[model samples]
Target: MEALTLYQLNRRIAELVTNSSTQNVWVTAELSDVAVRGGHCYMELLQKDPDTGATVAKARAAIWANVFSRLRSDFYIATGQDFATGLKVMVRASVSMHPVYGMSLVINAVNPEYTMGDLLRRRKEMLARLKAEGILDMNRSLCWNEPPLRIAIVSAEGAAGYGDFMNQLNGNQLGLRFTTRLFPAIMQGERTAQSV
Candidate 1:
């Protein structure tokens, strides 16, 4: 048997990676983590098993500063939303391997409308499922009563929305009174869905 050092193995892998795939291959996955450092955008992409809710695969991906800037703007223009965590995006990327970074995808393009369509389909499916289960009309199903004066707030404490809401409610000129308490939570990015 022959032995190879880490550098030798990585070099071989990098070579294999370079020759194995073509540029501009479209891939779809959920963004697990996203960060920007020194103008470069880096992210972790994850694919999950829908039925079992388990992660199927994960990959490191990057968008160069220049490419990220244009893609982010274009995505926002198409979707009216930020390109942040928890989005399932379709990206055109070149598969690459490095001696230090292992395998990664170099992203060059994004299809924001793909995710928008996916989200819309999921929402419609959820609504249909809820309706078929006789639970879709939750507000109408519940017994009627006047809305409660007391409210429990759940949001990140420093969020502008929270500040504005508190100010509007507390400083109402009509002098409407209510009891309110805020439960602070991470309001954005990957943690927000779990926070809520």
Candidate 2:
């Protein structure tokens, strides 16, 4: 029988992981938690069991400051979404292990299309769920207001479309008096839902 110190055991595991994996591989996982500190993006990635909804695997990952800055902008441009919690992402990363930190993935690139497709699929699934629950169109039976006089506008401040809509409504030749109120909201990115 032989005894191994904690450091010796951890070091052996680290060496095994580093040696067994490819230098850079593409992986898909859901972002369970994400944060930025000191310009670096740190994340918790996980995979859940489809049938039971239990997390089956999890890992820590990071994008260095230099890569984060560029990747963040490129991802947003490609997907029209921020790298936020709950996002399913496909990333190119290298598996690495540190004796103290255990195992982590060092992310270098992202496949925005995968996230965009996931979002679309999720939206469709949500709509289907709502329909099955018999609430998808709960307001469809509401009476329509003919010549609707009251307008409630939810839009970003200084939006050209809002201004144009107001101009057309207020400057109508019929001179129909209408009551209108503007409810400003953030129109894009992660905070859009909360703002609305």
Candidate 3:
């Protein structure tokens, strides 16, 4: 077998990936890590086995600045929720391989309505199953304040939402002071459980 330079091998792989799959594909994955920088949103996507809860696959994904704004706005409009970690999402992405980065997905669009439906169905199913098992809302027995004053915001450092929240806090008209601080977060994957 002929030994090729690392770059040559990766370049050939990239070419193969590029040629074999050129169309946008819909994929379902859990966001393991998420970050936004210079208007671009980057994500780590993971697929876990349902029976064993073991992660079976993972990939690096990115939504460039151009596609991210429109996709995010549309998602909020359709789903009435901000895209965040711990949510399963169906995104339309194109697969690619990079010499330095290896295999990954480049997301250009997302079906927000589809994701919203998935979330709603999952919530309803969970509630029903829990109620059937007679364990639903077991936490209701705990005494807790109606509105928690201490709110900790965890997000990517340069995320737009974090910036907006800081601005809103600074511009609060009411004198009601709340102790709040943003704890930096890796919003996409398993690392978050360790950090926050």
TM-score for each of the candidates: 0.70, 0.67, 0.68
lDDT of each: 0.83, 0.86, 0.80
Across 1-196, the per-residue lDDT of candidate 3 in tens digits comes to 9899999999998877886456598899887667789999988888999899798998889999998999889987887656677668899889888888888899998878677887799889989999999888787877876545578888878666677787887678875456787789765445767876
Quality of model 2 by C-alpha lDDT: 0.86
Give the winner by lDDT: 2
In model 2, the runs with Cα more than 4 Å from the true position are 1-3, 131-196
Worst lDDT window (10 residues) for model 1? 15-24
Superposing every Cα of model 1 onto the true structure, what RMSD results?
4.5
lDDT of candidate model 1 versus the reference: 0.83
TM-score, candidate number 2: 0.67
Which segments of candidate 1 are over 4 A away from where they belong?
20-22, 125-193
lDDT of 1 by residue, 87-167 (tens): 789999998888887989999999888989977997899899999998889878678466567999998676556887999
CA RMSD, predictions in order: 4.5, 7.0, 5.1
lDDT of 2 by residue, 130-158 (tens): 99999999878678777789889998666
